[model samples]
Structures are given as structure tokens and as C-alpha cells.
Target chain A: MLPGMTTRGYHHGDLRRALLDAAVQAIEESGPAALSLRDLARRAGVSHAAPAHHFGDKAGLLTALAVEGYDRLADELGGAGDDLLEVGVAYVRFAVDHRAHFEVMFQPDLYRGDDAEVRAARDRAHAVLRGGLAALPAAAPDRDALAAWSIVHGFATLWLAGALPPEAGRDPEQTARAVIRRLFE
Target chain B: MLPGMTTRGYHHGDLRRALLDAAVQAIEESGPAALSLRDLARRAGVSHAAPAHHFGDKAGLLTALAVEGYDRLADELGGAGDDLLEVGVAYVRFAVDHRAHFEVMFQPDLYRGDDAEVRAARDRAHAVLRGGLAALPAAAPDRDALAAWSIVHGFATLWLAGALPPEAGRDPEQTARAVIRRLFE
Candidate 1:
């Protein structure tokens, strides 16, 4: 092992995590469209080939981000309490706090859809949201789940896009709770 | 005018419309972030500089698209009949049919948010939705409007993102009506 610039001395496991972290910052700075593995590699202070080796290409890196995003979303939604209203608010909170992941996760065209990891991660997140719908009173479970997801997802998407009016406010969790409360009523 | 290859003979108004049409098709084929004026010019059979002259940059073109989108949304929402349910259904239809426009309109970072045309157009669409909410029984006009917008907007966004489960089915307008009907119930 040589000095700071030694290529062979760096751990592969650490490099992958560093690249993923750099991706989040890059996405936050510029929307996911401008994400480049080369930039991530440069930001991580690794050789250019390191990122390409770990993620293949732009879509591959985004798929990784999306997989991480879905898993995180599942963890948050499943742990946000069993109350439907609370779950709905938690959905919004996750989106706001994880804007980079949320944005990339939804734009399927931006990532590799065939990756098994992505599919499984997405399933986990869906299960969490769908499970929360069991508490709702609609005669049709599917339609009710769609309704519950849409209200929260739509609010989150609109909020992130800055499409909502000023009165909607910046407190995603609080505002989401108020709007979602109407559904239960 | 000398045949089809001359950029000098291309009318400014005609080129502008052609570029806008190209953008819609391009956005539909690839998500909005991948849109390039140069690619649009090649698609439109105009000089490379023609698009830049009209829209200035990538953001300028998207701003135009956003403006057109909002104005069109206002028209559809206002004319979807006096019933809020019908209006909500129409909103879903617009989103599905005009997916390209709808996608760009909401993502303000993709365009010039402060552009006068965008602001005015957005206000027109907002007024139509806000006016529709007045018929509801809520003491809080703004919150109710936000709720209505969130449900319909969320449903549309999910449908477009393919985020809703297969049980929600392939017909967006139908699923949207069923889900949105929850609010009216």
C-alpha cells in the first residue's frame, strides 16, 4: 500500500458506499438527469473505472439508488405506526426527507427495470403501503389502497415539484396528516 | 423558398410550433430530462440553431411547454362540466393523454419557474381547481382544495409512474374515478 493516490490499496466495499453517497449529493444538487458515474467516481476520489466497475453505467447506478430508496421507504412506512392516518403522513415525510431517492425511485425510465434487487426492493415498499390499507373501511381493498396511496403520493410529488400553493406550507408531515384525515372521515 | 433543406426560408412561427411538437414527442419517448433542442431540431427538419433562436435554451423550451400545459389544463378542467367528480375524471384524462405536458408542467425545476407566461398559465389552472372546490362543504377552502388536488393529482401521478398496483387495472380514468369518488362519499 502506497500513499493517498494508491489505486490498489482502496477497499472495494468502501468504494461502492462512497459512490452511492456521492450520487445522493449529486442528485440533490442537480436533478437525477445529470447524474454521471464519472462524476461520482471523481467526487469519491476514486479512479474513473471504479464506479463503472461497481455500477456498470448511469442506469445501473440509478437502479442501485432506487433499490436503496425503496428499502428505506419500506422501513419507514412499516415502522410509522399501524394507524392509517399516521402511515399516510409517514409516506409524505419519507418523500420530503429523501427527495433524491424519491425522485429517482419513481422515474422508472431513468433506471434498469430488470434488476432483481430493484424489483424486490420495490415489492417490499409496496407491501408496506398496501398493508397499511387493511385498516381502511372501503368495500374494495384494491381501490381503497389506490386512494390512500394516491392522496399521500400525490401530495408528496406536488410538494417536491413546488406545484402546490403557498398555503400547503412546508411541514409535509403535519399538512399530510390534515389532508389525509379527511379520507378517514 | 428553396425546397425542404433551407433554414433561411423557414418561418419563425412555423418553426416554433414544429419545435414544440417535436418536444412533445421527444418527451413522450424519453422522459423530459433527456429532451434536447438539438435533437428536436433534427427531428423537426430545421437548422440546429432554429430551436435555440426560438426558445433560447433547454429551460426556455420547457417553460413554453409548461405554459401550454397549464393553459390547456385550465381549459379542460373548466369545461369538464359543473360536477366536481366529472372535473376530477377530466383531470385524470388530461394527465394520461397529455402525459408529456403534464409531466413537465409540474416539475418546475425543469423550466423557468418565474417566467411570466408560466406564472399566468399556472394561475389560470389553479383558479379553475380552486373554484371547483368552493362547491365543497369545507369551512377551510384552501385545505379542501389541497385535498381535492392531492387525490386527483396523486392518482394521476401514480398512474403515470405506474406506481399503482395491477389491481388498480390498466384503465386509468376508471380507477381514478373510483378512487376519487371516495372524497365525494
Candidate 2:
């Protein structure tokens, strides 16, 4: 429970969620370079060391964010049902919508890779992608999966970085669907 | 020239190359987070300030490396001689061989983005890719070019990040070629 949190007067059953939310806001405004536990605590209206109790360190907080991101991504993408292309589009959508988590999740150097929670969360997300890939035709599923994953991931990553062409005109979700369709064609 | 380096010393004309070489070695050893101009100068047996004379700043040094990388990539892809798939394969090869530059070039925040030299070099590389893409069949050239570039760039980026499956057993160049071939199929 951070000191200045909106739920400061309460025992705040979900202090962890509050911290994570504050982290995302901080990351969005300052980028990953300025992430700080004390600032997070201040923003959350808890004691300066409250974040340390929950996350242990900056890396621990980042690991937690990565885990949450993976879980959310897996849930969103998995819910796309039988449509592999839809799942691909959902993956891109998750990235765009959760920019802060998406940014930290991929930069392995920024988090504790060996943490069991992080590992399990990451594996869960990967399983969703693999599952979606398996839904494709069996003739050359592995290759097709790799191609599909590569295009969607690449496009989403580039688009977030503002490297994609403006003339493409299609929104990120539409662009992802268009690219994934070509993979099967 | 960084501090302790001298035009009158035994290594002057070659010192710039030596410093760049040392920078690559450092990036490989510790990743980009650990890169420091003073550290590079120390490793090169020069004073901390000596690097400034040659590169002006850390961004300048990185920009120089990026410019060199773009030139090398353009040359390699150009040598593929108008075969779109071959050019795509060459793109993957460049990413693998020049891992340091490939990593830095894409991370726009880490370099001097407004430098004319860097922009020119990057544009030259883009021209090579665009030229090869233009050689594809006339129908839907715009979409085809975007797809072709996306697949090759996506494959190379993912492969370099160790996200691709090792059990696939296919070399990067082969995988790149296969992915690109799907565009026309």
C-alpha cells in the first residue's frame, strides 16, 4: 500500500494491483528508464518501503508486471477461439493497449528471467500462441506458425516504435489480420 | 580521440577503428546497458575525454556504427542481384553477422536520430530492400512489398532475439527464403 494511494484509509486488499497500475502509469509517462520503487510507493500512497515488501526490488516489480502482462495476453489471445488470424490480431491489440507491459516484457534484461512466477506466466502466453498456431492446417504447421507469429509480432513491435509506414493506412488490428492472411495464402 | 589517445601516438589513424571494434566487443560481453564512453576509452588505453574528439558523444559513436552497418547490409543484399527471395535471405544474414549494429539500429532512442549521415545510410539500405521488392510481380506491388519486407524483417528480428525454435533445424537464410517464397505462392 503506497502512502498516497486513493485507498489509503482502507486495508486495500488489492495493494498489488494498485502498485502494478501505478507502475504502468509511471512507465507511460517517463518510459522504462525512470521507473522507481519509491516513486511507485509515493504514487500509490503507501510507505516508501511498501513496494519493496511486495516486489522486493525494481527487478521484482518488473518481473511481476511481465507475468501479469503474459497472463492478460494469453487470456485475450486464447479467447479468440478457433480463428488463428483473430488470435494474431488480438495479440497485436494487447500489445498496443498495454504498451507499458509490452515494452518491459520483451526486454529480458530488465527483469528476473529465472523467477518461477515470471517463467510460468511467460510459458502460459507462449502456449496460447502455440495453441493458436496449431489451429492452422497440419501440412506444415510449424513453419506456418513461425511465419504467422513473426509477422504479427514484428508488425506490432514496429508499429509501436513508430517505424511502420503511415501510408499503410490500416489500423494495427486490420494490418495484423491482413498480414496473417497472406501467411496462409 | 578519447582522453589519453593522441594523434602523435603509435595508434592514431587506426584508433577510431580500434575504438569501434572495442565498443562491439563490450556490447557483446555485457549488452547495451553496460556501454560507457569512459569505459571504452579505458579499454582502449586512452583517457575518458579522448573519445569525444572523434565521436562527439556516445550517440555519435553509435550512429557511426549504424551507418557502417546499413552500408554493409545494403551491399550484401544488393549483391543478391535482384532476386527478391535472395535479398531477403541476405537481410537475415546481415542481422546474424552484425548483431550489435542490428540491435542498436532498431532501438531509435539509443542513437542520434537526426544525424544526416545516419539517415542517409539508413535510407540507402531501405532503397536496396525496396528495389528488390519492386522486382516482384506487378499485381499488388505495394502490398507485396510490405509483406515481403515484413516477413524478412520479422524473421530476422525474432531469430536474433532467440525466439525462434532451434528444433526446426533450418538455417536462418533458408528460413528467410522459405518465408519470402510464401509471399508469391
Candidate 3:
């Protein structure tokens, strides 16, 4: 919201977006498991009940994050063009850049995986991934998709964990492109 | 230990191991972030102070888990012989069978990453992974290793998260083998 343009009590659609943005920041700093709806409300400069009204509770908030994450991922992967290599690189980049959302989206325990919005968004993201793989020749198409998904997901997860050795160095995306290209060989 | 082999007040070396084992179960059920040392001590049927004595705090216990996880990973990967394919398969197997350890091992923030024991074990594990990649030809061998690591790691992570399509079916190892073989192809 613009700094001084809003009335104190005026409700706007921007509140939800602002609250979700606050959630991403909070989850990034404190992790998904420690996220608090009350704190997010405080961060958003709203009444304690404001976030709960929009999200119902913590799980509800996380469910929204997962859905939003998948939608954003679908956008990124969809925009990566038709090349499987570039698509794979884009997937890793999305995970690294949206670390908090990526974490919640995958860990079903963190949110309701069966939520209608979550399931729909997840399917959309999966479709984008499979669409990118259409250019590749494979002994088994299904298994190939799994392979592509696994390697990129693993790299991003490892990179986030700091489990990968420092050898990859400085920039995750460039190093990821070099690493991801090996699958084609 | 067998149910019948019981003794009261026995201070065997097993206390730490037993506590660590309990931690694995707790972590698997809840998560690393929700881990409680006091609760672990209770589950292990020890004094409340027992867990703290052995681990200092929750981070201390997680640090122990990280060390043990890296050591175990090294053992599995090292024992897979010179074939990098088998080593990758073994890596996924380790993640599935020891899900808790695998989860904590990657997330550096969950424990003390800079501790001497953790750094050494991490190096040993890294050495095992790099050793497995030695059999492959690549434009860049080090990045190839990272690629190899990322794929298997990503697959296992996806599988654990239940993020993979149901097509993966009831058997993770079988599905994982097929996907992992693609890296070699």
C-alpha cells in the first residue's frame, strides 16, 4: 500500500496481497513451521483478527502460499521457452528465488495438499514441467519426466540447505545451468 | 534390544544412541523445527536432564543428527562400489529409509553447520558423492557431480514430499531406479 494514501480503517483487496507478501518475508526469515498469523497481522499493520479473517488460520495461510507458489512457478516455467534445458534451469531458479514458498509447496505436511486451490495449482505447475519435456527423446517418457523433476528439485533443495559444496560458487543460476546441461549429455 | 533384556538404571553407551533414535522418530512425526529434547528424553525413559547432558539443547541434538546422517550417507555411498549408478540409487534409498536424517542433513539451519564434527562428516559425505561421479565423462566433471547429486537428491525429496505424481506407485525404490538410470543414459 502507498505509505500515506490510505484511510486507517479502509478495507482494500490490497490487504490480502500485503498479508501474503508479509507471509513470504516471515517464512523466509523464521521458516514455515514457525510462522504466526498474529505476527503477520502485526507486520502488515492490521488488527490481530485481520489476517485470520482472510486466511482462517496458519494452515489456511500456508495453503494459500502453496497455491500462489505453484501459480508463480507455472508462470516462470511456462515462460522459459520450449527447450527442456532452459526449462530445467528456470525450475531451479524459481526454487532458489522463492525459497519459502518452494519449501511449503513441497512439504505437504506444512499445508493441506488436498485443498482444491492447492491441487489445481500443483497440477498446473506439473503440466508446465511435462510440457517442457516434450522435446526430449526418452526410453520412457514418464520416467524421464520424473528424472528431470528430481535432479532440478534436488539441486535447488541442496543449494538451499547449503549441503552442496562451495565448489558451485557465487551464483546459483549459472552454476545450475552448467550442472543441469549435463543431463542432456 | 529385546524386550526381555531389561535392567534398571543401566548407563550403557546406548543412552545417546537411544536418544538419537527417539529424535529420528519424533522428527519424522513432527519435523526438525518442532523437535523437543525434553520430549525425546521422556520417550527414551530417561531423566529430563538426560537429553541436555548428551546434547546440550535441541540444536545440539540436531547437530548430532547431522553428523550421524553424513557418516551414514558416506557409508552407503562408499559401499555402493565404483559404479556411479548404484551410488545414486543407494543415495535415494538412504533418503527413503532414513527420512528424518536425510531431511535434517540437508537443511543447514536446523543444526550447527560450522561445528567441527559436522564439517568433517559433511566432507566425508561430499567425498563419497564426488567419488561416485568419477566414472562419468563430462564437459566439467565437478559440475557433473553437482548435476548427479541434484537429480537424485531432488527425486528423493519429491518422493518424500509426496509431490510426485501417483504414477510413481507403491514402490519408491523401483520408481527411483528407473528415473535415476536416466542420468546415466
Candidate 4:
């Protein structure tokens, strides 16, 4: 062990969170293909078996990350006041800021979607969007919700992939607001 | 060899197209992960190595598939007549009808983005949309084009992921039309 490294212990109280943070870093650096529990453990400076004890397997770690992602997304969008368009902007902002989490969360085949925590978190994030849409006029709440979700999610996903044009120089939040405004115009 | 199967036959003139068709079927059935060149060859009733003669590797095969997808999308959208909303509706129709192609085309990491054929195909598809947008008044063409592309592409992507609720029961084409109509309203 390196000097000042505390490796003479196995009772890592925050091992689960540490492993998840390491996984996010790994995904950001190398994409999802390079994720491995052993590699994550090594990066976390814990024994190779430590991550297994906390997460059970690679999928479990990803599920935890995704669950956390949903909660974070919900919190961010929920704080955007009662303006539906602002909530849409917040949704895009969350995706841009947390690209790793957003990417893994949507790829259903990468993690067990039925994981209780993951499902609950996803529902919470979804409910935040639903609530925002509910505040819209009652003529077509469902349509507006789907449209708003699609525009923000699409913009964020495309921007992160570097698929947008250079001329699209506006910040993500601005672009999102502009697009969402057009939805109700 | 199995009965009626000739190993040394020189009749693979259409093997390239056949392989692409089989790949589309495979992708639709199992998504991008389960696609295999050997399996595609088997489905095409050709020798295992025959696909290699047309596509250098699996990525090459996918590149060709993406190219075809872009061409088909351009054709569908271009044929939507003068109604921009109808064009958006056709975009969603393409996604629903050609789920396999839509899935592979968007995954930038999976295909050779720099390939000349792929670039040309993508540009052609983009031109179709650009041309459609050019027909609108000159005042706000740039923002209008971006919004139009984002809405249609985003809606199709979300719908295919089954992210929308069934109670939103509005068909994708109908929903796309409504969203696009709002852009001009």
C-alpha cells in the first residue's frame, strides 16, 4: 500500500457509494464497455472482493448508480419552480451535467430494470415531469408531457454525443428553453 | 454440407444486399448486441466467410446498414409533400416501421462515423430535412430547422424506447404532427 493509505481495514462504511462513484468515473473515461467490478475495486483502492460484497455484481453497482441518477434528476427538475418549460430546461441540464449516469440509466440492457431502488428512483424522476405537465392547461396534458420530455431528452442526448452543429452555440439550458417555448407557441 | 447446400458455388452476386436484409431482421429481433456476421451469413444461407467479402467486419456491415437507413429515411421524409407536419409524422413512421435501422443508426460509437459512405448517407438524410426547412419563410429558418429536427428525432427515439405511457395512446405519427404543428402555432 502507498504511504498514508489505509488498506488494513475491510469495514468501509461508504464502500457502496465509493464503488458507485468509481464506476461513474470509469464509464465517463472509457464508456460502458470498460466497466468491470474488479477494475472498479482496484480504482477504489479496496480489495478485489470488496465491491462484490457491497454490490453483489456489476449490474448491482450500475443499478445503484442509475437509482441515484433518477433521484438527482428529480431533485434538479423539481426545483425549477412551476414553469413547465423551465422544468424541461432543467431536465436537459441534468442530462448534460451527468452524462455518465444518464447514458447508463437509459440503456435498459445494461442493468436490471426491476431493481426496487432503481425502479423507485425512475418513478420519482418521471413523476416530477408528470407533475410539471399537470400544471399545463388541461386540454392535452399527456401530449404536452410527452412532447416536452422528448424535446429536452432529445436535445441533451444529441448534444452530449456531439451530434449538434457548431452553429448551435447556445448553452444547453438556453437551447432547451427555446425549444420548449416553441412547443406551446 | 447439408443437403442441397453447395459450398463452392459462385452465385453470391446478391449476397451483399441479402446480408444487409438479414442484419436488419437480426437487429430487430435481438438489438445491436446480438448481431453477428456468422449468424447473418447462416441466415442468408451463404458460407460463413462470404459476408466478409462484402463487409470487411461487423462494423463495416453496420455502416452499410446505417447508410441504407439514412437513405430510406430521406426518401420517406422527402415524399411527405408540402406539409412540414406531415414530414415530421413520416419521420416517426420510419422509426416505428424500421426499428432495427433506427436503433443502429443513432449509436455513433458502434459505427465508423468517418467512413465516406456513412458520411454521405447521413448528409443526404440531413439535406432532406434542410431542404424541407428551406421552404419555410427565411426569417427564422435556422432555429426552425433545428427545432423541427429535434422534435421529430427526439419523439421517435423516445417512442421506440417505450418510454411514453400507452395512455398517451396518440399514435406516434399523430403525436409528431401535433408537436410539429405547435412549432408554427
Q: Which numbered prediction scores highest in TM-score against the true structure?
A: 1
lDDT (Cα, tens digit) per residue for candidate 1, span A70-128: 99999999998678888898889999999999999988889986689999999988888
lDDT of 3 by residue, B132-183 (tens): 8877776688888888888889889988988888788768778877887887
Interface RMSD for candidate 2 relative to the native interface: 2.5
Docking quality band of candidate 2, CAPRI definitions? acceptable
Per-model CA lDDT versus the true structure: 0.86, 0.78, 0.86, 0.79
Write candidate 2's Cα lDDT for A1-185 as tens digits: 56644346634447878888999999877566568899999999888877898889999999998888989999998899768889889988998999999878876677887789877888888788888877666566667767777777777777776666665665888777777777666
Tens digits of per-residue lDDT for model 2, B22-109: 8888876655545789999988877777778789988888888888888898899889988888888898899888888777777666
Candidate 4 at A175: error in angstroms? 2.6
Candidate topping lDDT = 1
Off by over 4 Å in 1: A2-10, B2-10
lDDT of 4 by residue, A1-185 (tens): 64533374434556666778889899887666458998998898888988888888878778888888999999998999778888888988888889899888876666888888888888888899988887767566666677777778778877777667766775888876776776665
Model 3 — interface RMS deviation?
Answer: 1.0
DockQ of 4: 0.42
Report the poorest 10 consecutive residues by lDDT, candidate 3 chain A.
A2-11
Worst 10 residues of 4 chain A by lDDT: A2-11
The lDDT ranking, best first, is 1, 3, 4, 2
Please state the error at residue A13 of candidate 2 in Å.
5.6
lDDT of 4 by residue, B1-185 (tens): 54433474434545677788899998877677568889998998888988887898988988888888888988998898657778888888999999988888887676787889878888887877787776677455666677888888888877776667676565777777776666675
Stretches > 4 Å off in candidate 3: A1-10, B1-8
